[model samples]
Target: MATDGQILRLAQWLSPAYPVGAFAYSHGLESAVATGAVADGAALTDWLADILRFGAGRSDTIFLRAAYEAPPEDLPRIDALACAFQPSAERRTETTAQGAAFARVTAAVWPDDLPDFTYPVALGRAARLHDLPLGLTARLNLQAFLSNLVSAGIRLIPIGQTEGQRVLTALQPLCEEVAGLALTETLDDLAGTSFLADIASMTHETQYSRLFRT
Candidate 1:
């Protein structure tokens, strides 16, 4: 279980104001919107739900737990696997850059030796160092991840704020399921079957006019 202060720390780390530059990256959502694969709040919800269950959400949770449970000396191996799991150059940039930024900011404020690994790995290690509960950390991480993408959808789809919130609300159960499933899985199960999402990311790399980095 997590103490209130510990939970608050998780919220603080994943909050938009944390300066992870999350707003600048859409995780291929920009392309999905432009291509009309995600034109409305409902579509956005379904698309992001797939991503959470089969893509980065599932894999990152595994990596996060791997980092949390592993001997500290073995974190680099997990980080290597996380980096290698990315499907494209931009995808790699998205995770690694955010990871470095997250580690740098968190280390400065909390005074830890948090390494600049991929984002999930960095966050997992930080939560462990802070003595936060693993399940709560993973759950909130999934929520914050979905929340960020829904925010991106709000801007790209030009949906009303209420609709955006609704999309997020619709995703809550899926996030819970993925977070729960992730806790039961191991690194070997870190696989992504979201090929269309990966293609959207690759296509975004050369999109003529883009608003996101990946």
Candidate 2:
């Protein structure tokens, strides 16, 4: 169990205003909206659910777990895998850019020497440095990711605030489920079958009049 101060630190790191610039990335949702793939609250919920179960959400959770548990010397392999795991250029940019920014800011404040890594890998290192529990870290990261997406959906899909909150509320159980699985899972078990989401990311790379970087 984490102490109260540990929990607060994790919360602060995962918060939306943490300087990670998460608001500038949609993880492909903007393209989904443009293509009419996610046009309403229900569609948005299903899209998010699929990703949580079988997309970046699952893979990132696994990566975070692996990095949190692995020795510092082994993190580079994990980082390399995370970079290669990105299927699209835009997707790659999304993770690496945020990861870089996250590492830069956290290292400056915490005085932990961090290697260049993707967001999940960087987060896992930060968790270890802060002595935060892995389960709590994973859960909070998932919630943050979901919240960022819902915020984007509010802008792109035009969903009302209440509807957006409902969508996030619906995903609470799944967030717990994914976090639990991530805690016990190994890197080899990582796989994401959210093909439509992957395609949307690829399509997002060429999307005209975009509001997000990915």
Candidate 3:
């Protein structure tokens, strides 16, 4: 059985019904597939694996954990950190829009006192308010990210439904590792190393025909 708080948090973040618009962004997966960078199941698996292991998984997790534990006064500093971390213009826009969306939805429902919590910070605070364990919160957030990416990949690569599920299954181990790593990470550890992804996101902005916002 689940606790009331845990259930509520999961309902808010993990539900496809949430209005965060998370389902709309691929985090650059659409651009990569359009460019023939990720064509099939194996390639999709590899790309998503790298992201979970090295990109958002590591960096966003650190931010989320720190935001979860930071003093309330430090929220603005954390938002600035989030802004600094995103190097690409499109990616930056994506995070900012999503963060804003999350803040709006949360504010409408819970009405927190802070001016605006960045996406990761708002999520951390929401998790705490909903009584979610840190690990569960991180895991679910990462899962949503991967799921959205794959959903975008399915459209861009024009793959069948089965292939998408296979890709998702193949990346499960990597996602688990990422979540475990995030649980013990510190704020100073917030970083990512995927120049290709950054470049792809930047290029995506100028792409004449884009299926995704980022």
Candidate 4:
């Protein structure tokens, strides 16, 4: 269990104002919207739910737990695997950029040897370093992840604020499920078959006019 102060601190670290530039990336939703694949709140909910269940979201939480328990010396290998796991150039850039930003900010605020690993790896290690509970960390991280993309959907698609909140509300359970799945998962379980989302991210690189980076 996490103490109230620990929860508060974790919230602060994952907050939208955390200087990680998470808001600037869409995790491929921008392309989904451009192609009309995600137009309304329900469609957006389906897209995010699939990602949370079978895509990068699942794999990231797995990596997060692997990082949290791995020996410190093993982090570089995990980080390398994470960077290699990105399916597209834009996806690679998005994770690494936010990761580097996360490292820089967290290093200033906490005693950290954090590196420029992908976002989940950096975050998992930081949470461990600060002694935050993995369950709460994963849940909140997953929520923040979904919320950021939902905000992007609001801007890129025709979704209204209430609609967006509905989407977020609909996806909350899956976030909890995925985060819970991360608790006992290992690197061997790391896989994401959300091909459409992957292609959306790849295709977004050439998208003529884009509001989000990935």
Clashes by residue pair, model 2: none
Per-residue error for 31 in candidate 4, Å, reads: 0.8
Model 3 TM-score (2 dp): 0.93
Q: How accurate locally is residue 153 in candidate 1, as Cα lDDT from 0 to 100?
A: 87
lDDT per residue, candidate 4, 1-214, as tens digits?
6799999989999999999999899999999999999998889999999999888888889888888888899999999999999999999998889889998899988759998888999999999999999888889999999999999999999779998999999898889888887677888878888999999999999999988889
lDDT of 3 by residue, 21-77 (tens): 777777887778878898988888888888877787678878888877777778788
Model 4, runs deviating above 4 Å: none
**Residue-level error in angstroms, candidate 3, position 47:** 0.6
Winner on lDDT between 1 and 4 is: 1
Off by over 4 Å in 1: none
In model 3, what lDDT does residue 190 have? 74
Q: Model 1 over residues 1-214: C-alpha lDDT tens digits? A: 5788998999899999998898899999999889999888878888998899899999999999999998889999999999999998899999999999999999999799998999999999998999999999999999988888988888898798999999989889989999999999999887899988999999999999988898
TM-score of every prediction relative to native: 0.98, 0.98, 0.93, 0.98
Taking every candidate in turn, the Cα RMSD to the unseen true structure, in Å, is 0.8, 0.8, 1.7, 0.8
- Model 1, CA-based lDDT: 0.91
Best by lDDT: 2
User: What ranking emerges by lDDT with the best candidate at the front?
Assistant: 2, 1, 4, 3
**C-alpha lDDT (0 to 100) for residue 36 of candidate 3:** 89
Lowest lDDT block of 10, candidate 4: 181-190
**Residue 63 displacement (Å), model 4:** 0.6
